[model samples]
Target: MSFTDSTEAPIYAGLVEEQGDVPAEVRRVAEEVLREADRAIDFGTVGAASAR
Candidate 1:
């Protein structure tokens, strides 16, 4: 998914690069955070949501 607001290339190459090879549970939570951040960003602010 498109996470960052920038038009520049993403800092990390991919999800694997961003979160590393963590456990399933950790990865799940990380993905949720990413989604929430993206959601909040879409609404305008990074703090728009609790988990954003």
Candidate 2:
């Protein structure tokens, strides 16, 4: 799922909006990280691990 559709998106949006001075690069990196995290959560491990 896209970052905007993730659960954290609203909170992140609120924080970012409150911090109006956030730099463009920082915003870009933060959004990228969020998107990656969202993707990971959406496509996480599908089964229990075998005994190690």
For each candidate, what TM-score against the reference?
0.37, 0.37
What is the C-alpha local distance difference test score of candidate 1?
0.62
Candidate-wise lDDT, in order:
0.62, 0.66
Clashing pairs in 2: none
Q: Deviation in angstroms for 26 in model 2?
A: 0.2
Which candidate comes out best when scored by lDDT? Answer: 2
lDDT tens digits by residue: candidate 2, 1-52 = 6344337688656666677536766889999999999887854454434322
Model 1, residue pairs in steric clash:
none
lDDT of 1 by residue, 1-52 (tens): 4444234435533554677535666879999999998877675543566675
Q: Candidate 1 — which residues are off by over 4 angstroms?
A: 1-22, 43-52
RMSD of 2: 11.1
The TM-score, computed over Cα atoms with residue i paired to residue i, of candidate 2 is 0.37
